[model samples]
Target: MGFNGIRPNATRKEVLEMIAVIMRDDNDLEFKLDSMNLSLSISVVTEIFWVLNWERLSALRFFAWIRSSKCRRFDFEGAKKMLDEMRQMGCDPIVDTDNYLLSSLCRSDKTDESCQLLEEMQERNCLPNPLTFEILIYHLCRLGKFDLVHEFLDRMISNGLEPRLTTDAAFIKGYFNSLRYEEAHKYVVDSSV
Candidate 1:
């Protein structure tokens, strides 16, 4: 993902991560992070390495280059800065639930920050999979919150994503949690693998 006119190519894992950051979808990102070799993978993207190494004057130079460039892509410098600051303040580098603060910032209308978080996730190599959205939707349904479920299901459908069997089970469980046994049983019949 060419954030900031840098035009760097991300690895498969990196593409997965960037998507996670952009979407704020967590499940697959976390799973991939645990399996990858972060040490070697870190070197896969050079522009990002340059972004982290920038001195103030160098950063200004980068900004000038981006402004003059017509592409005007999603850049990662600001994200690198904020993430670096957070790390200095003791945030862990791994994909922690704390990262979901990006979602809250999103819900509260901090669209830019949310996007920054997603970009950062991409830089680090997190992949958000279908189960990710399913997990969120299932939890909402467990609480009998149709509005939230409706919102996520719509988002998933509109995005052309579908849930897996395990995710279908989660929805059934969620319905059972909400004491909607009839509905849960109906889902069990239609959704069981």
Candidate 2:
């Protein structure tokens, strides 16, 4: 089947046969998809992979591909579905997975969704690493959302997850940018203490 013809549960026997053949190969699904230049949506890809019973490694590859710069056309909804599919398949996302998703969301300027996902990660005990916080904090600060920066910083501290100096600086800069010098200076002092 041609790449453009690929869709969720494609009825064409050729497409089904081709997908099975590809899955049987040693190459990764994302590689196969990209090589074919398939314009398949994520849902279609997810369904195809699910039907092929290729979730374990395929989920990782899908997340990695979605996080890559080459995947400029995908969106959060698809990514979210992919993650959900992975979790439902007993593949709980790791910190790296969370970081990849978080970074992707931030890159897309979906800061609000990123923040919510960060909280979800915490609730799921898929703790965010320094890099995750840095990405969200930096983006929030850049957008002059100092309140969110502070809230995230506090959440980080409460969770005993120390932000790096650069993240702290971003928060401080965010405060100052919003003309909250007192809060910024206090943050510097409190963090130092």
Candidate 3:
């Protein structure tokens, strides 16, 4: 990832200058990236992301950006668009990346959008790990969306993810509150096995 003599901690103006040069030469961002062998380090990507104000970047670039920086403030719609673009580009984001995005969404109280992103992950055959399930289930439980919790629990079980006891307890309580006694009992019995 030669940055064409761009040093570490490049200023925003420098990054923009680089972008201008690339865009001027190719007018195709992806093509320019491919030509430059744009496997950038996280720091460089972070600098670029900050410079671009976290606009909807390409999937690979966005991944690098996220990997390089702490995304404390997320634009949910922008992140979702980036995920969709990543899928379209056939670049399946790793579970950790998804988890980071999920956590950010949950922190912002964007539970519904988090669920939608999880569904998108499923559609792409990107299996969610236990943490993924935990984040969504916890938020759904907080929102009193027991019906969704049950569905996510079912998916978790089918995916071979053993639900943590605490998460299951919350799920059970939600189920009961939602008058889903049968489902609650089913999970209780299954867990005891």
Candidate 4:
């Protein structure tokens, strides 16, 4: 139950070695990971996430594991560190990785931090995908941050991405929930035009 031979007190190096084994046995990744009884720290999870970045499926499975397991909560600092470490190693994290961080930040009610990270992602030339904008817009709308939501929506369109109908509904819902009935009505009317 120890990562398929990883000791309970395994160091970062050992955990990394285990990651290698997991990568090599890609077909059995879920089975191997599910069988392991490891409690990973934030830093270790970051490292493992970085290592799995290039392997989309593995990274996704690992991300799901991180979410469901008793692993430490991921924070903005951990995400920043992972990105910085990747840059130092002569690589940039993929957009999916950034999206994951954004989702995590938003779920934690750290929308401000997520916005900051979005800026950093742009500065690093890691252009965000449509999902990125959707994530931010959804969270911002939920928090009744219409100003930022509008801003992101504009940015999303400028990037040649159309806002999904769900996004439009979220905006309308946000206005309604905020007790701005007039604004919501106006929005629906104007959008129809």
Candidate 5:
């Protein structure tokens, strides 16, 4: 920005372009540090993730960033090892991006695996909110986990999240697809009631 700044020679646009490259390159700390002489802060990481269109990043790479940021911020372990290494050197990953990965996994009928990821987040003190629980429960329902569906309903009620449109729709769709006409009609009738 000013004289003798690390990026003094680079225009603001170029600096942003460099950051974009670093983000796409998986936040190669060595390259970023060596070239930019800048520390990777939470803000920087967030900007990078957003610039990269967080949704486009692979789950593994996204986790890598999360783990990296965690390790940098609090020395927490990510869901993987290499990401921890990145954090060791100074990488702060984007939490929202990581949450999106969990959401995607939950929607994929990989609730068990998603649970593992959630556990990892919890270990890092990242407790999911109602929306996360809603997604997990909805996916479970879509996957035909009737028992778990009821269990989640109970949990959501206890958590003070009333059954929502998506929840009802998922149940209706699953019941209909399973040819449980009686149960589906019951739900429809109950909705009317």
Candidate 6:
């Protein structure tokens, strides 16, 4: 089937044609997918790969592209629900998975929810890594939430995790953006000490 004829219930052959058209366009894949309202799952994607009879390397690239596209959309409630379901199935995701969700929450301006997730992570014995701390601190700084920033910084240090230079830069930029020059200067001086 041609691109215009493609629908939600399109046959495998039609989906293949749509994929071919998308690849040929070399334009915005996400936009095309969005316009088409295509809801492709991993299984369907893998099936497409097998049907295409592509080499392993090509299939890997396609899979990565699909995953990246999906990751660009932040659906916090959907993610949380999926996580809850995973837990119910006695299948806890790894720390990295939680970190990804945390990053998504932060990016979506749900920093407060992200903080609650951090607490949940702790309760689950899932220790937050440096990236997790960085994600929270960066977004909190953007919001000028210095109190929570400092609290997390202290907690990070207590856990023997030194902030990255990017973290330091975030603090400086955040304070300067908020016109808290004195605090920024003090932070610089104290760090030197």
- TM-score: the better of candidates 2 and 6: 2
Candidate structures ordered by TM-score, highest first: 4, 2, 6, 3, 5, 1
TM-score of decoy 1: 0.36
Task: Indicate which candidate wins on lDDT.
Answer: 4
State each model's CA lDDT, in order.
0.48, 0.70, 0.66, 0.73, 0.58, 0.71
Q: Could you give me the TM-score of model 3 versus the true structure?
A: 0.55
Minimum summed lDDT over a 10-residue window in model 3 is located at 64-73
- Candidate 4 regions exceeding 4 Å error are 1-9, 12-17, 24-31, 34-72
Question: Which scores higher on lDDT, 1 or 2?
Answer: 2
Give each prediction's root-mean-square deviation over alpha carbons. Answer: 16.1, 4.8, 11.3, 5.3, 12.0, 5.9
- Which sequence of candidate numbers ranks them by lDDT, best first? 4, 6, 2, 3, 5, 1
Alpha-carbon runs more than 4 Å astray in model 1: 1-128, 190-193
Poorly placed runs, candidate 3 (over 4 Å): 1-13, 16-71, 83-91, 172-190
> If both were scored by lDDT, which would come out higher, candidate 3 or candidate 5?
3
lDDT of 4 by residue, 40-140 (tens): 66567667766677565356566555543422345357456655765786656678877877888888898888999889888888898888998898899
lDDT of 3 at 69: 35
In the range 1-193, model 3's lDDT, one tens digit per residue, is 2344324455556556656644344445444444433333444544554545455434355354444333442545555555565556455568878888887888788877898889878887788998899888887877788778779888998999988877887778777877879988997898888
lDDT of 1: 0.48
TM-score of each: 0.36, 0.67, 0.55, 0.70, 0.48, 0.65
Candidate 6 total steric clashes: 0
State the TM-score for model 2. 0.67
Error of 2 at 143 (Å): 1.1
Task: Summing lDDT over every window of 10 consecutive residues in candidate 1, give the lowest-scoring window.
Answer: 66-75
